[model samples]
Target: MDPRQLARSSVPRSLPEARHLRQDDRFLLVTSIMPKNPAAVAHGPMLIGVTINVLLMGVIVMQAYEYFTSYKRRDDRYLKSLVVFVFCANILNTGFAVADVYLALINHFGDVQYLTVSTWLFVTDPVIVGTVACSVQMFFAWRVQVLTGRWYLGLLTASLALGQLICAMLMAWKCHQYPAWADFVKFTDLIIAWMTTTILVDVTITIILVWYLRRHKTGLEGTDQVVDRLIRLTVQTGMLTSVWALLDLVLFLTQPTDASHLIFQIPMVKMYTNSLMSSLNSRPKPKVFSEVTDNIHSIAKFVNHRTTMQDGTMQFASSLHPEAAAHLERHELGEFQKKTIEAASSGCKGDAKTGWDNAARAI
Candidate 1:
């Protein structure tokens, strides 16, 4: 210690030989400050995740580019706009998460950062990511409504999105003022409970959506082939997101605070990057004329509207296939296609080639 400096405080510096004293002033004289434990520090690289985030950012930019391309080409305006909006929100959320990690890294408190990002980032940043994430969920459901022209799934999706947003925000608020929430549990347990609930619900909801898409009417003869592909991509993206959610919850719940969070969170970020990939590939496919009416009526009659064809549109014949009976019995388009094809086959109206004769020609 400097002599003049020590004189102002009237504390003598402890030399190597005299450093054994256990007194508080003696301790202060020996070392001016005590640092947090080294065990909590984040260190070393986790290449897999960092690499993935790098790729995801690339994908987000690409999706935005694709959306613009579709509009420039005068393709389907609705799907293009949907893609742009979803991708934009994803990029914003991902940026905030990545930035939060970087801030923790540069703050020189890697240990604290490693164990408490859910608190540090979740609580402090006003939670734009949660908003975006739930919006993406609502988008998934809304697209289904667009295809079926029914509002049942859209309403359900909207409700779930709202619920998720509330829970995420509540947890963030609890962390922001831990004192206000009253330190109700051990820090580790508290965080684990929060993570478990959030991730589980997210995963379950994603699984249900994927299942719904797989069973929906989409095929060359049944539904738009293009829409089917988009549905699949959305489900796949949702499934991947669920996987990350589970992993994040488990790790944060099980691992000690001193564990290398950089090692894991980067991977968590990577897992999260799939939203960008899904968004970029989300453009609507080229339309094929094949149609099946009422994909969701089979699940449950959420809406009770009578099915009818428009006045100017051509109504087709039903098929002999077993699927035809169910299609005709339930919805107007199914009967129209079955009859349209039948007449074409029986040599009564349009040629078979233009009608059901080549149902396989669907895009």
Candidate 2:
């Protein structure tokens, strides 16, 4: 064999060996380090936690805007205090969420096991979210009490809210003790209790409020329309919160290891806050029904608190239904006031009192 031909053949053999050596080195490098778990990588807890934090930040902005804009509009001191508390809680939640993302993603990147370990930041979520949730529930409970005149039902709802808060706080304390996200299943009982109470309170409030509004739907077209709107609003807000809580509970119970529940958990507080703010801000304007609905002229039937008989002894009759009195008080103008305001705005030329009386008597 020629020396050059032999050398070329040797070069090919050496090339193969070199390639094998390189492949072995790469294999050693890959295997010596931990092989990444696709499941773990794909469903990174940090991914869910951080994504939720972003969403939470957006919601916090919404909450701030709502508070500032409605501050002048809301005069109820109690409600004002609750709003302040929710705003503060929302801020605290955002802070905790930021810390959660930083700890899980930035501080311990690729250390996926640490993601299963609960930290101080992770536990704080239940506390802050629970506080906001319970406060909102109680506020609606109070409304139920006022509208339905059923103190027992209101107390029941409030008590349920308190129960949920206790369970949530308990869960937080437990998380702080364990500090392991994987071990969350150990506290399944507390989770069930907390989520159950929340769902019950939401549903109870919705049912009672809706029933009361439906019952108070005075046959008059305008009043009935207002009642219908109120019913729809009640269902919408109540269902949204309750449904989220229920989903969270279901996912937590079924997939304790997976962070799937975080999807519902993250935005839960925002739902509660937005629902409360929406209801408060949407206080019906009397003009909505009185001015817009042409059938309001039928209200003349219920006008005039006083009637004169043949004997001329003055008699006062209230046309308001006891069940509807609260609803009407909130949204409807008194007969005299309605007539006077309508007359003034309409530029009707007449003695306002006389015209109101005449209209009332005609009914």
RMSD per model, one decimal: 9.6, 10.7
Runs of candidate 1 with Cα error greater than 4 angstroms are: 1-18, 21-55, 71-126, 146-150, 179-235, 256-273, 276-349, 352-363
For 1-363, candidate 2 gives per-residue lDDT tens digits of 332232333333423653344444544443344334422532354457557656766766775675556454534466677777887777777777777667756776646456547677767788888999999999888877766657899899999999999998998999888776666778888889899989998999999988877765557776566667778888999999999899988988777556678777765777788778767656534335334323334443443323333443223344333224323324222243444334432322433344434433221
TM-score of each: 0.55, 0.72
lDDT of candidate 1 over 19-93, digit per residue (tens): 454455554553453233322333333233445555766766765665465434543455456555655655665
After best superposition, candidate 2 residue 112: deviation in angstroms?
4.1
lDDT scores for all predictions?
0.45, 0.65
